[model samples]
Target chain A: MSRVHDMGGRYGDGAVNPADNATFAQDWHARALALTLAAGALGQWNIDVSRHARETLSPKDYSRFSYYEKWLAGLADMLVNLGVLTREELKAGHATGVSELASRILKADAVAGVLAKGSPYTRDGAPNAEFKPGDRVKTRRPAHNIQVAGGHTRLPGYASGLIGEVVLLHGAHVLPDSNAHGLGEAAEPLYAVAFAARDVWGDEAGAWDEVVLDLWQSYLEPTA
Target chain B: MHFRAGQTRATSANLAAMPHDHDHDHPHTLLPPEPALRVRALETILTEKGLIDPAALDEIIETYQHKIGPQNGAKVVARIWSDPTFRKGMLDEPMPLLEELEFYGRQGEHMVIVENTPEVHNVVVCTLCSCYPWPLLGIPPGWYKSDAYRSRVVREPRKVLAEFGVDVPDDKKVRVWDSTAEVRYLVVPERPEGTEGMDEDALAALVTRDSMIGTGLALRPEA
Candidate 1:
C-alpha cells in the first residue's frame, strides 16, 4: 500500500481526458507491449512477477514514465535479472551472443492460440470459503506490516483495514501477494467486500456511494 | 570571468536581444533518438538473442490492433438487451455465454458482468493496475488507466463520472467495483428508451465503448 502504484483517494489530479482512445499513441507503444508479452511467453516468469517488477521501479520513474515506458523498463530488468540477457548487451543495443532461451521462443503461429488459451489463475481443490455473502468482516492491516507482506500485495492502501460486509464470495483463487514473490500460489478464497464511501472518505464521499473490492481471504481477519 | 551583478544584468539583457548568442552555434540535437529507434533496438536485440521472434511480436500487435476490441463488447451488450434469456444467462454465469459467443480470452479469463439500472449505477476501476476485459473491450483507454480516474473514482464516483458527462442521480446508489484481483468487470449499461423497434445489429450501434465501462450511457435512439 505504501507503493506509488497503490493510488486510491489521493488528490490533486487533473480530469480524466476522454478524447484519446487510440490503443497505442505511438508506434513504439504497440512494439513495447508486444515485446514484453513475447518475452513473457518464454515461460520464465508469471504475470504476478511481471507486475511486481513493473511497480518495483523508483517512485520518480514510476510516476514520471508513461504507462508502456514503465512496462519496457520492467521487461528489460526482468530479462536481465533472469539471465536471459545482460546490461552490457542492452547498453550496446546489440546481442553479444544467442540466448539459450532460443529453444523456448514463442513462434508467430502460436501467438493466437496462446492468447486465446489465456493463463487462468483459477485452480481446483480449494477449501470451503470461511466467510459467506452478507457476513460483516474486516480486512487485516497487512500493509502496515509491510516487512511481513514481502512487498507485493493486491490490497490497496485506501481500502485496507476498513470494515465492510462480504458482498460476494468468488471461491478460491491464486494469492497475488505470495504468487508475486517466489512464495508459491497459496490459492485462497476471494470475496467482494463492500465499504461505504462515507466510511472510507468521510465527508468528501457521497452518502449513497460504496466501493467493493475483490480481496483474498488472507487479507481478511479470521473473526467476523 | 564573471561580471559584477549590475554589469551582468545589462550584459544578459543585451545577450537576450542578440540574434547570435551561441544559439545558432548548436543545432537542436539535444534529444536522444526517438522512441521508435530505441524500440527497434530492443526488438533487434531480443530477436538476435533468439529470445523473441519479430513475427510473433507483429502478430501480437496486429491482433490487438485489428482482431480484438470494444466492438465485441458492444455486440455482447446488444445481445444482452435484445435477448432476455441471454441477459439472464449472462448475469447468472457469464463465462459460459461469453465462451459460447467467443468473447472469452486473455485478460478476460475470469469475467464478471454488472448491470446498471434506474435505481443503481455501477462502475469499474482498478486502482492498482489496469485489469481490464481485453478480449471484449480491447486495451483500456488512457483515462481508464490514469491516476485521476483510479485514485478518485472509488471515493468520489459521481465526480469522476461527471468528467465523462455521466451524472448519476442522487437517489441512485453508486457501486464502484475496484478490481483488486484478476477478475475483470464489464458494465451492461441500461438500454435507452425508444429503442423498441431496433434489432440487435441496430442496437449494437447504440452501444458506445464508454457505456460498457459505465463512464457513459448507450446512445438514445433518434426521435
Candidate 2:
C-alpha cells in the first residue's frame, strides 16, 4: 500500500499540463519505448511482470528516472533477473559472450505482425462473474500479511478499503497481483467499480464527482 | 548527490524544470545526462547477444510515430457518432468495430468504451502506471502519465478537468476511470446537437485526442 508507484491522491504535485502533449519528450524516449516493447517479445516475461519489475526499482531510481527511462531501467533489471542477458553485457555495452538462451528474438519482418496481433489476456471459458451491475462492494484493504505484503497490486492505495459500486462487468481477465510475482496467470472477473469522489477525497472534491477503477474480483468484497 | 528517499515523485520533474540552478549542481541528469547514449549502448548489447533486432526496434518506433496515433482514435469516435451501425457495433462489443477499422493492437486489446452524457461525464487515468490504449490513441501524452495527473485526477476529476479547460456542472456527475488491470478505456464524448448532417470525416475532425480521453469536450462543429 505504501509503494512509491501507488500514487493516487498523494498531494503537492503541481498542475496537469494539457499543453504538454508530446508523445516522446526526447529522442531516447522513442528508443526506450521500442526497445522495451521489442525486448518484451522475447517471451521471457509478461507485461504484468515487467510492470512489477518497474515498480520494484529503488525509490530513488523510481523517482529519478523519467517515465521512459524507468522503462529502460526496468528492462535491464528484468533481463538480468531472467538471465536473458547479464550485468556485464549491459555495463560493457557488448556481449561478453553470446547469450545461450536466444529463444524468441523478435525479427524486423515479424515486428509489425506481432504488434498488430496483440495477445489477448482473456483466458478461455472463464466467465464466472460474482457481481452484477449496481451491486455495492468495498475494495479490500491490503491485509499486510508478512508473506504477501510487498508484491505488485493494481489496486491503488487511495481507493483501497473504500466502498463502491460495480458499474460494469468486464468478464474475466488476467490478474496482475498473482501474475506479477511469477505465480502464474489467473483470470479473475474484472469490474468497473465507481467510488464517490467525496468519499475518496472528503469535502474538497466536487459534489457530483466519482472515481471508477477497473478492479479484479479479489480486490473487492460484497458490501451491504 | 542522492535525493532524500522521502522526496515526492515530482522531485525529478522539478529538478528537470529548474535547469539554471540545478543542472550545474547535478552533473549527471536523465539518470545519465546521456539518455540517448545509454539507450544506444543497451541496443548494441541486445543486438550483439542476438537478444533483439535493431530493425524491429525501428519498426516499433515507426508504427507508433507515423503509422498510427490519436488520429486513429478520432476515426473510431467519429464512426460511433456518424454511423448508427458503427455506434451500436462499438457499444455492443468494440473489438469487431476496432478490427473493422484496423484500430486494434497492443495496450488496446482489452477495451471498454464509456460514453459521456448530460447526466454523467467520464475521464480516464492510470493511478498505478500509465495504462493507455496505444493503438487507438497512440502513446499517451506526457501529462496523461505525469505525477500531477496520476495522483490527482481520480480524487478531483472535476478540478483536474477544469484545469484542462473542461468544466462539468454540479448537476452533471463526473466519473474518472483509473485503468488498473488489463482493461484500457476510451471515453466517447457526447455528440454535439447539430452534427446530424456532418459526414464521417467532418465528424472525425472534431474528435480531439483529449476528447476521447475524457479530459476535454469534443470540439464544437465550428472547431
Candidate 3:
C-alpha cells in the first residue's frame, strides 16, 4: 500500500526484509520467477476471457463492466474446471447471495499470500530521501534494454531525466511499472510529481501544459 | 431526426471529399483498402446473421462521432478559465472534481490533472496501448493513436514535438507522462499572459481543445 522506492525495484535493510537473504533469501529469486510466470498465465487467462466476452457482449456493456467482474467470471470457469466450485453452487450463489459470496471471496487477505513470494512485503527501514514539495528533481533512467525476468523497469522512455516538482509521496510500494511489466524488483519511496509544460518542452510548449507522473523514489535524484 | 439526417449528409460529403485517385500502377495499391473491405464484409455478415441491428450501429457511430469528444474538453477548459477556484480544485484532485461535474465516462473515475507552466511543457502517451484522458478530452487525436507516435514520442519527445511543430529549446527539458493504470490524465495548460482584462468567457474562448491535450497552447487575443 505504501510507495517505497522509485526504481520500480525493492531494496532496503531491515528484519525480515523480503528483498534480503534472511527471510526469503534462499527462495527469493525462485519465488519472483514463479510469481512472474503466474502473472503471465493470469494475463493470458484475462485475454482469453475478454476476447470471448467481446464476442458475446456489446462494447458498451463490456466497457461498463469492471476488470474484477470479468476476472470473477473467469475464476468461476477455472474453479469449475478444477472441481472446486460446482456449477449448481455457483448458480445458487449468484441467484440468492451474490453480494455475500462475492464479499467473502474477494477479501484481500485471501489472495495476498498467493503472490507473497514475488511481492515486495519487506519490513525494511524507512526511506532516506528528504524530498519535499517544490523540490526540483530528475528521474533516473535505467539502462537501455536491461531486461529482468518477471520485473518491469521503471525507466519509461518518456520520464527519463525530466525535471518535476514533488507533489505527493505515497509510502514504500512495489513499483507497478517494474513489477508488473517485468522491468525490475519492487522497490520503495514512490512519489507522484507534477511537471510543468515549459519545463518539459520549453517556450514553444503551451504555457499552460503540465503532466503528473508517479515515480518510485529510486527513479529520482535531486536536480541542481 | 434532423440531426440524423444532417449526419448522413455530412458523412457523404466527407466521403466525397476523398481524393479520387482510382488509377494506380501497382495493383496492390489499386485494390480497395483492406480495412475498408474488412469493415464492409463485417457489416454484411453482422446484418445477415442479425448479430447487431442497424439502428444499434447507427447509434454507436452517432454517440462516438458527434456526442463524445472535443466538446467535453472545450467545456472543461471554459469552466477552468472561468473559475480560478475550480482550476485549483481540479489541480488538487482531478477525478473527484471531474466526477462532481458528472461528465465522466469509462476509465475516467481515476483521473489526474497535470498543469503546464511557462517554464515547462508536458505531453502524455501510453506505450503499451493508446490510453488517453477520454473523459475530459474525449478520444485521442489520430497522431496519438498511431504506433510510431506512441513508440517514439516517449523516447525522443523533443524530436517528436518538433514534428508536431512544437520546438523546445535545447535547454528546456521535455517530460513525457505515461499512463499505466486505469487512471487518465489531462494537461492543464497555463493561462497565457496579456489576457488580464478579458472576461472569463473571452478567455475561455481562447482555450483550444489541443491545449487541453498538451499539444498546443490557448490562442491569445490580438491587440
Candidate 4:
C-alpha cells in the first residue's frame, strides 16, 4: 500500500541533512528506544508486525514524529491492541494494578547475550532456489489494493514490476509479508536483483548507475 | 568593505560555536512539553509491573551507544585493506570472518561485503526503513532515514555522492545496493592513495563512516 514510509522515487521532499547523525537528541528519544526494544523482546509480536504498526500511523503524525517517537507510538498501539495494557493505563501513565501477562521479559544480564545471538531470518525449507546469479528476471507487479487489505511487505515501491538481473541467490529466508501477518514462516529463495538507472527511473537517472534490491523468489519471474 | 578569507572563516567558526544564539528548539516541545516526565512515568510503571528490567534497558542503550559502533567495522575494513588473504576471505565468505572478529549477530547476522574498485563504486541504502548492520555500522545516521535520501538515492546516487563531496568518475559504474531483505551489506571502500607505508591501524584511521556507506572517499595521508 502507498504510504509515507514508501517514499522511493518520489521527489521534492528536501535536501538530505548530512550533519544530523546524532542517534538520540533528547532524553525521551532514548526512553522511546528502550521501551520499544524491551516490550518487543518479549516473545509476543514479530518485528514485521511492529513495523506495520509504525507505518499505520496517520501520514501527518508519521511525518511529524521523529524515528524513535514513531517507534514509541507503534509500541503503544501494539500494547493496547494486544490487551496487555489498557487505554486508561496509557492515559494515566501508570499500571492499573492488573496482572501482567508478560512471561518472557529480557533480563538485564542477558541483554548482551541475546543481542549477540541475533535473530536470523533464514529457515530450513524445501523450495529450491529458482534463479541463480546472472539469470535475467522481472519483478512481479505488486498487488495495488494491498493497503486496503492491511498487511506488510518488503517490496519497495520503485523497483516493483521492473526488469533486472539476478546478481546473487540468498538461500531460503523468512518471507516478511507472511511473517508480519502471523502466517507461518513462508521461507523462500531471495536474490539480489540489479536494475539499471534507465530501467528504473527513465532518462533522469545517470546512464551508468544501477540499483540492486534483495528480492524474494516469489517476487520474480523468468525473462529472456 | 569586503572581509578577508581568514576573517570570514573566523566569523563562521564563531557563529557555529555560539550556543542557544537564536533558536533553542527541542522537537518534543511541539508534541508534549513533559516527554521526559512521561517517559519516566512509563519506565517506572513498566518496571513495577516487571514487564521491563531497568538494567536490561541500560544494557541495550550502552551497547548501541558505546560498545558497538562504526569503529568495529573500521577495524574489519582496515584488516581487509592491509591483508590480501583477509580480503579474499572477506570477499569469499564474510560472515565467518566477521564472526571471528565478533562483528556478527543483530543486523549483521547475514552479511555481504561489496568491494569498491577503480572501475566500480558501491553504495548502500535501504529504500524501505533503515535496515543497517547495527553490529557493524552501529545505528544508522539520521539523514539515512530522511525522506530525501530514501526517495532520491536510488534515482540520483551521483547527485547524493556529490553532496558528500565524493565525485565518482563518470566512466566508473555506480552500483547502489538497496538493502531490501534481512541480509545487510557493507561496502569495503577502496583504500585512498599515498598511504602505502601506513600500518593497518593507520589505514583504519583513514576509514570514515561515510566511506563505508560510499558517500565519501577514504581519507588520504599527508604526502
Q: Pick the candidate with the highest DockQ.
A: 2
Please give, for residues B1-223, the per-residue lDDT of candidate 2 as tens digits.
0011132121223212322222222212223346788788788888888878888888888898898898988888888887888778788799987876778878888888889999989899998889899888999999998989999888777778889999888898888888887788999999987788898899889888999999988888875
Candidate 4 ranges with C-alpha deviation above 4 Å: A143-148, B1-38
Provide the TM-score of chain A alone for each candidate, in the order shown. 0.94, 0.94, 0.41, 0.93
> Per-residue lDDT tens digits of candidate 3, residues B102-121?
56654354566767765667
Model 1 lDDT per residue over B71-180, tens place: 99999999999889998998888888888888877898888889999988999999988888999999888888888888888878898899898998888999999998
Q: Could you list the CA RMSD of all candidates, in the order they appear?
A: 13.1, 7.9, 19.4, 12.4
Query: What lDDT score belongs to each candidate, Candidate 1 first?
Result: 0.79, 0.78, 0.46, 0.75
Candidate 4 has an lDDT of 0.75
Q: Over the stretch A72-126, how does candidate 4's per-residue lDDT look in tens digits?
A: 7666666655656666666666777744444567788988887788777777854
**Candidates sorted by DockQ, descending order?**
2, 1, 4, 3
Across residues A72-110, which tens digit of lDDT does each residue of candidate 2 receive?
777776666566666566656778866665656788998
Candidate 4 structure quality by residue, lDDT tens digits, B69-102: 8898889899999899999999888888888888
Total backbone collisions, model 1: 0
Error of 2 at A220 (Å): 1.5
TM-score of each: 0.90, 0.90, 0.49, 0.89
Q: Tell me the tens digit of each residue's lDDT in model 1 across A1-224.
A: 38888898888877788886778988899998899888887776677767877777766667977788777766776666566767677777889989876887899999998888777777667766889988888887745424234357888888877899898887788877765554556788999899998988998777888999999887887542
Q: Say which docking band candidate 1 falls in.
A: acceptable
Candidate 3's interface RMSD, please? 23.8
